[model samples]
Target: MTLDDALAALKSHVEEGRAEGMAAYHKQTREVLGIPNPALNDLTKSWRQTLTVEERVALADQLWQSDIFEARIAAAKLLTQARLRPDAAAWALIQSWVPDFDSWAIADHVCMAGQKRLVADPSRVDAVEGWTQSDHMWTRRAALVVTLPWTKQNNPKSDDLAIRDRVLGWAASYVEDHEWFIQKAVAWWLRDLSKHDPDRTRAFLDAHGEKMKAFARKEAGKHLT
Candidate 1:
């Protein structure tokens, strides 16, 4: 389908008055199509089933360039699959969107899609590591957000454990960044990691909790004990 057709399909699902409320909630200045997430989820699922990877990537790029909030969300959902062979294009496109991230809502959705690609190719973390040093807080935050899958492995092997530790090193470096969102991302990674590796979580807290914002420190320790 063409971009016009996809935009038409998305516009068809907009809810009356929800757009205004969503815009305010997300602090979004762009066009906010008041489509609920379930609708976008269903829409992208069908699109994924029908569209080839190249088609979906092209469409996702169009939707993202539209700068319409829900369309961006749909773009992210369109590529959120766990397995997409030769996903280099999708991964690269997602990377291209990083510098454009200005809000948590869209960034989180795209980062979820990114988690799939990163897990599909863990070596990509090398590129993601550079994001940790970016001046853009959201981009730096995306580094933690996308790497979150490493936190959930119940019985991690040597390499998975190595990745998990590597991401922790990133989190540790973030402790000095006092931005609320950055601290939250660090806490989020640790909180999730705590479920699967409490000892590591506690160790992180013991070593760096003294420097963390109280809320983040509490959040990182929430699952422990």
Candidate 2:
């Protein structure tokens, strides 16, 4: 379907009074449709099944440029699938959106889409390293959020273990960042790592926990106990 068709479908499901609340909660300046996520999820699921990859890419790009809250989210959901065998175009589109991230919800949604692509080709980690060095906090934060899969490998291959250590190094670099979200991202990675690899998680905390914000440290250690 076309962008107009997709947007019309989303607009049909909007909750009348929720837009203001969503905008306020997200601190977003863009138009908010107040469409619940489940509706968006279902819509994108249907779109994914119906549309060709090129069609989905075009629609996702249009929806993202519309600057409407839920449309951007729909754009992300459309690309969240794991099995795009030759996904160079999809990966490129997701990367293009990184510099524009201003809010957590949108960034996280896009990052979720990105996680699949990154896993499909781990070489993208080198590009993600560039995001960690970006001036935009959300871009920096996306590096960790997108690599979260590395945090949970109970029976990791040697390659996976190396990836885990690489991400941990990124987290350690972030420990000195006083931004609440950065600290939270570092803590989040450690917390998830704690579930499958407690010793490494504990070691991270021991080395960098003292430097993290108290709330982040607490969150990182919450599952440890």
Candidate 3:
């Protein structure tokens, strides 16, 4: 379907006063239609059922360009599938949106879509490595956000272990950033990792806790025994 068509569908479900409160909560200046996520999910799910991968990619691209809050989210939901064949377009589109990430909500929906892409092809980790060095705070944080899957493997194979350590290394480097979001991202990775790899979590806290913000250190070690 067309951008106008997709947008019209999105506007059809707008919940009157919700948009204003959502914009205030997200601290965003963009157009917020206040369409709740379930509606977006419902709409995109139907769209996904009908569209080809390429068609979905084009529609997602347009929705994102519209820059309305719900449209961006719907764009992300459109590509959130894990089994899209030849997902190069979806992956590339998600990567292109990274630099524009200003709000955690949109960035996170896009990253949820991206997590599947990265899992599909781990070589993309090398490209994601480039995000750690970006001047954009959210881009740097997105590196951790997108790689959070690496934190969930309880009995990860050697390659998975290596990837976990690599992400931990990035978290180590992030301890001194001081931004609340950065600190939270680092702590989030560590706290999640602690569930599957307590030893590594403890080591990270021992080595970097002093450098980390107080709340982050506590949060990171929260799951450790």
Candidate 4:
């Protein structure tokens, strides 16, 4: 119920020897709890069921401020549900975390939670567009990662199609960035889009792939055939 109580619950799951390996893997300098994802998943699932929306928000904020790896992951999982009606607070809190992202593991988990909010209200993409212009790479990358749902629609309606293209425009803007993560995010969006919309994927590669890093270009075209 309290932040200390939630953190104590997280600490109870820490594995003794795994902390160093997790820190090395994520290249994160923060305190790593070494709690495996399955355990964190199970824990946060129970927390989500047991806690009210405001309680979850407060807990997630505290967990994130702890700067402990697994605690941050737990914070994200707490708000990852798709049907949190009137989720303005959850969505706002998730947005607040974007600029603080320093690792892919944390950013990806937060983005997963973000995808649910975006799906609940597509207009949120307008706010996400600002992330594309952000000076932070992780914030920029979050834009693509969170909008991934747009890639999976095999029979999207006109509005969904528009949203998909809007995200593609963001990807295109990122092509010249040359950062490994940015290129990867661009390729990830394109590669996933290739699965359901090969034409758009190919078109993206044809236009911007030439400007992307060679590895990213290859990845963007991986499923194009």
- In lDDT terms, which candidate is top? 1
Candidate 1 lDDT over 74-173, as tens digits, reads 9999999998977999999999999999999999999999999998999999999999899999999999999999999998999999999999999999
Over 4 Å off, model 4: none
lDDT by residue for model 4 (31-79), tens: 8978888889888999999999989999999999988888899999999
Question: lDDT tens string, model 3, 1-225?
Answer: 989899999999999899889999999899999898889999999999999999999999999999999999999999999899999989999999999999999999999999999999988999999999999999999999999999999779898888898988898899999999999999999999899899999998989999999999999989887
lDDT against the true structure, per candidate, is: 0.95, 0.92, 0.94, 0.93
Worst 10 residues of 2 by lDDT: 83-92
Query: Per-candidate RMSD vs. true structure?
Result: 0.7, 0.8, 0.7, 0.7
N/CA/C clash count, model 2:
0
Name every residue pair that clashes in candidate 4: none
**Prediction 1 TM-score vs. true:** 0.99
Which segments of model 2 are wrong by more than 4 Å? none
The positional error of residue 19 in candidate 1, measured at the CA in angstroms, is 0.7
Q: Give the count of colliding residue pairs in each prediction.
A: 0, 0, 0, 0
